[model samples]
Target chain A: MTYCLGMLLKDGLVMISDSRTNAGLDHIAVFRKMTIWNEPGDRVIVIAAAGNLAITQEVIHFLHVGVTLPDEEEPKTIMSVTSMFEAAQLVGAAVRRSYRIDGERLEKENSGFNCSFLIGGQVGGDKARLFQVYSAGNFIESTADTCYFQIGEMKYGKPILDRALSYDTKLTQAGKLALISMDSTLRSNLSVGLPLDMAVYHRDSLELGMHRQFDEHDPYFAEISQRWSKSLKDAFLALPDPSW
Target chain B: MTYCLGMLLKDGLVMISDSRTNAGLDHIAVFRKMTIWNEPGDRVIVIAAAGNLAITQEVIHFLHVGVTLPDEEEPKTIMSVTSMFEAAQLVGAAVRRSYRIDGERLEKENSGFNCSFLIGGQVGGDKARLFQVYSAGNFIESTADTCYFQIGEMKYGKPILDRALSYDTKLTQAGKLALISMDSTLRSNLSVGLPLDMAVYHRDSLELGMHRQFDEHDPYFAEISQRWSKSLKDAFLALPDPSW
Candidate 1:
């Protein structure tokens, strides 16, 4: 299990992913799940994936090498996509390609071909966008009414995002909410752990604004974790006890 | 889908269950998921269920009628159980009996025999106990270190419980936490909804201390829902935005 979140705010896009991966309870490792394709001033594509590590890694490999859609004559890689929409389509095609290669084998072993991706960023003149690509390879973009997407172990962290995030939120504030959401997930689930990868892309910059790795001992993350927990406790205590 | 929660606290037990039952998105109805067998001064047994409505209903029926264990000649009903552990066993036995009657048929339909239960309360000369009965009819009791159980649509509501609940929490406070947890779930999930049924049992009282049903119009629930959202937003704003 893993946790990855992407928010498309009015100011920019904020994306975060955890580094824990596990084949089972006993076999766990830190495997970074965020990949960036940045060609400064031309395009910046970011993808955070969750699901079968092998499958997701293979999808990333396809994105790196290139993918050929049925109607296309030439293969297109993430770095070469003309627009954010093309980037999302390339990701979907890669997922489908992975399915064609491994889906049947996995089904025979009773393992579903599970993989999903949160792809977001800017490409040249196109507006910044965020998309959630499904295991089936189909994808949906975040709209004004729904400006965020979360994949993997999402529920524990969702209430905070649902309550706090909006399309009008500032890019930095959205990053803070994403971290708080991840903190909630880390506290409740063992499969999602430390060393998070986060990236902020300022709209239309066609370049990454900020990218950082957060692990244990990261002071800002530690402060956010401690202070958020304290605030939740304080808020809970302030609620009046039921008189009945 | 449903959400049922039970907490075993120093003061007693707090149990809450939603009343929504759905066959599919097109088919939904309100059916109370909680049942209580109160034999004053002898025992008080509360059962909250989640999963296939037919299977859970059958399990509840078996509990009410009686279940005869392999080693026992006489069948036992929840009200007849002497200890809280025995009450759990009775509930488990009821689940197994339900499986025997419908599990294979449901599996043939690819439904996976889905059903689980949260059972808690006290019996004469016994302490208050909380147990989460699984689909297979096995159950685990909550310990001092982990004094709560939640079944169905549980993840959205879990973070608050993990952060706010404790074995030493007062029963009323635990009830408040449960309500807040339920509010979070209700906000995030359409499958779990209004008209919640909650029961609180004071330890050694051998009877229910308080029982209430909260609907959409309930003022206190309305207050908690609004205030908690405001508090969470305030807390999020209080966290410093990332400088990077």
Candidate 2:
């Protein structure tokens, strides 16, 4: 299981992904799920994935080499895309390619070929964009009305995002909200562990603004986790109890 | 879909259930999911259910009338139970009876036999107890280490309960936490909605302590819903942003 989140805000984009992967209780392992393709003054593409590690890794490999999207003769790679929408299409194509190779075999084994991706970045002259690509290779772009997308173990961390995040939120503040959401998930689910990969991009900058990995010993992540828990307890206690 | 929560606390028990039931997006109605049988000075049994409304209703019906547990010669009704454990067993028996009648048919129809109940109350000399009965007619009682059980649409509302609730929590405080949890679920899920049924039981009382139905227009429920959202936003804002 994994938890990955992406936010498209006025200032930029915020993406976070947990590093824990488990085939089962005994097969847990640390695997970074975020990939960044950065070319200063040109484009910065960030992708966080969740699901079968084999499928996702294959998808990443396809994205890196190239994918022949439907209705196109030549293959396109994520770094070679000219627009954010094309970048998303390339990711989706990669997913579909992975499905073509492994979906049937995984289904036969009852694994069901589950995988999804959050791709958000700016390409050349285009504006920043965020998309959630499904296992079926279908995808949806984030809009102003719903500027955030979360994949994998999402429900436990969703309430905070629904309450606090918005399209107009500042870039750093959105990052804070994403970490808070991740903290809620980490506390409630054992499958989603520490060592988070995060990338923040400034809109139209065509370069990654901030990138960091947070482990159990990261001071800032530790502060956010502990302080958020205390704040939530305090906020809960502040609410008036029912008089009846 | 539904969301029902049961907490076994030192002061007593707090049980809450949302009233919304939907067969599909178009077929939604208000049907109370909680049933309280209060035999003053003798016993008080509150049962809250979730999943496959028809099956849950049948289970409740069986509990009301009678169920013959395996290896038992005669049928035993919930009211005839001698202890809280017996009451839980009776609820489980009722679930099994419902499954016996509708399980196969539901499976053939692709609906599946899905139903679960949270039964909590005190019988005569027994201490107050809470148990979660599964569709298989098996059940598990709550202990001090884990004193809460939630069924149906549970993940959205679980983080708060995991962080703030405990067996040592006061009954009213636990009730507040339950309501807060429900509020989170209602916001994030369309299937779980307005008009909640709540019952609080005081240990050794042998009677329902506080029983209330909160509709959309209820002032206290409205206040909690509004204030909790504001408080959460405030809490999120209070956390520090990443320095990077």
Candidate 3:
């Protein structure tokens, strides 16, 4: 299992993902789940994936090579996409292609075809966009009313995002919200472990504004995790008891 | 769908459950998921269930009557059980009997035999206890190290419990923790709904100490929910931002 989420805010986009995957407890391993495609001033697309590692890797491979659509003069890669919407289409097509090859085999083995992706970034002059692409290759774009998308092991961290995020949030604050959400998940679930990859995109910059990895000992994350826990306990203790 | 949790604490026991069940989004209804059997001064057992309503109801009926063991002189009901452990076994036996009658047929229809329970309380001289009974009726008791168990739609509400609960927590504090946990689930998932049923048992008393139902309009619950949200937002804001 994995946990990946992305926010589409007024100033830009924030994408975050944990780097733990496992077939079972004994087979746990670390695998980076976020991929960044940077083409300088033209486009900067960040994709975070969760689900079967093999399937996700195949989809990523397909995207790296390029995705061909019917009637298209040539294959379109993330770097070549004209808009964020087109980039999402390219990723969805790759997911469908991988499904076409492996879905039947997985079904026969009683292993469900489970994979999903969060695609968010800017392309040329288009505004930053966020989308959640499902296992079936279909997708839904996030709007101001729903400015974020989460995939895999999502429930544990969702209440925070539901209460804290909005489309108008500043890029820096959005990044903090994303980390706080991830911190909640890491504490509760072993399937989602650390060494997180995050990309903070500033709208119209077309450059990877800030991309960093948080390991188990990263000081800032350590501070956030410890301080958040203490603050929650303090806050919980402060609430007036039910006047029963 | 539902969310129910029980904590076995040093002072007593705390049990909380939501009152919503649904076949789908359109077919939701309010059905109390908790039941209490108190032979005051002798035994007090609170049972909270989650999963197929029909199956859980049948199991409750069986427990109401009695469950026969191969060597027992007669069927044993919760009221007649010798210990909290025995009472748990009685409930498990009832669950198995219900499964014998319906599990195969449910599987034939692809509905799947899905159900689980949390049983907690005290009997006679026995200490307060908590057990999580699985769909198969097998159960494991909570100890000083792990004193709480959650059944059904549990993840969204679990982090708070993990961070706040301990066996030494007072019964009142445990009740507050349970409500905080339930509040998070209610905000994050539509399946787990309001009008929560809660019971606070004081050890050695052997009777139901405090039992209450919190509806959507319940004043105290409303205050707790509102205050908790505000506290979380404030806590998040207090955390130092990533120095990147």
Candidate 4:
């Protein structure tokens, strides 16, 4: 299992993904789940994937090689997409390719075709966008009413995001929210482990300005995790008890 | 769907269950999920169930009518169970009976034989106990290391319990924790709704000292829900920002 989330904020976009993947408790492994396709000043597409590692990797491979859209003479990679919406379409096409290649085979082996991606970034002058691409290769773009998307092991961390985030939230604050959300998930779920990848896309920058990986010893993440836990406990204690 | 949780604390037991049951989002109804068998001074058994409402109701019915135990000369009722463990076994027997009556019929209609239970209370001289009974009629007791059991839509509220709860927690504190946990789930999930039933059994009392139902207009629950949201937001803001 994995957990990946992205927010399409008015100022920009924030994306975060956990690196741990496990087929079972005994077969746990660490593998980076974030992929960035960047052409500075032109387009910067950051995607975080969760679900079957093989399927997500295959989808990423197709995106890298360029996926062909129907009626289009040439294949278009994330770098070639003219806007964030087109980039999401390109990602969706790659997901479709992965399904075509592996879905049936996995089903035959009694495995469900499980894989999802959080695509968020800007293309040239287009505003930063966020989308949750489904296992079926269909996708839903985030809007003001729902500015964020989360896939895989989402429930544990969702209440915080649901309560705290909005489309107009500051980019840096959004990044912090994403980290806090990830921290909650990491603490509650063993399948979602450490070494997270995060990307912060400033609005209209068309460049990946801040892409960082946080390992166990990363001081800032460590601080956030520790402070958040302490703060929760403190907050819980401060609440008035039920009158019996 | 339903959300019911029980905690076995050194001071006593805390059990809470939401009152919503839904066949689908449109077919939702308010149905109490908690059952209490109070033989005050002798035994106090509280059971909360989740999953197919019909199946759970059926299991409760079997328990009320007295369920036949393997090789037993007479059926055993929850009121007659001598120990907390036997009360759990009696509940499990009811689950198996429900399954025997409805499992194949539900399967034939493409529905699952889904249901689970959280049983917690003290019986006679036994220490306060907690067990999570499964659909298969098998059950697992809570221990010092893991003193809480939550069945149905559990993930949304689990992080708090994981971080804050332990066997040594006071019964009242555990009740507060359970309420906070339920509040989180109620906020995050539509299926787990209001009008909750809560039971707090104090150690060695062997009586149903506090069993109350909080409806939508309940002031205490409303206060907790509103204050918790505010407290969480305050806690989030108090955390340090990412050192970007």
Ten-residue stretch with the least lDDT total in model 4 chain A = A120-129
On lDDT, who's better, 3 or 4? 3
lDDT of 4 by residue, B1-244 (tens): 8899998887888899999988777898999999998887898889999999889988998888899876787998887878888888888889888888888999899898999999888887777889999999999998888888899999999989988898888777777888889998988899999899999988899888799998889888888778888988888888788778
TM-score of each: 0.98, 0.98, 0.98, 0.98
lDDT (Cα) of model 2: 0.91
Name the 10 consecutive residues with the lowest summed lDDT in model 2 chain A.
A91-100
Query: Which tens-of-lDDT digit does each residue in A27-133 have in candidate 3?
Result: 99999999999888889999999999999999999888898854576898777789988888888889888988999999999898999999999888888899999
DockQ of every model listed? 0.90, 0.87, 0.83, 0.81
For model 1 the local lDDT of residue B35 reads 93
Error of 1 at B19 (Å): 0.9
lDDT measured at residue A179 in model 2 versus the true structure, 0 to 100: 88
- The residue ranges of model 2 lying beyond 4 angstroms of the native Cα positions read none
Compute the DockQ of candidate 4.
Answer: 0.81
Candidate 2 per-residue lDDT over residues A70-96, each given as its tens digit: 799999888788898998888888888
- The global C-alpha lDDT for each of the candidates, from Candidate 1 onward, is 0.92, 0.91, 0.90, 0.87
Candidate 3 lDDT over B1-244, as tens digits, reads: 9999999888989999999999988999999999998778888899999999999999889888889754677898777888888888887888888889998999999999899999999888988889988988889999999989999999999999889889899888889889999999999899999889999888889899999999989888899899999999999888887777
List of clashing residue pairs for candidate 1: none
**Per-residue error (Å), model 1, residue A29:** 0.3
lDDT of 3 at A114: 92
- Across the candidates, what are chain A's individual TM-scores? 0.99, 0.98, 0.97, 0.96
State the lDDT at A128 in candidate 1.
92
Clash pairs detected, candidate 4? none
Top lDDT model? 1
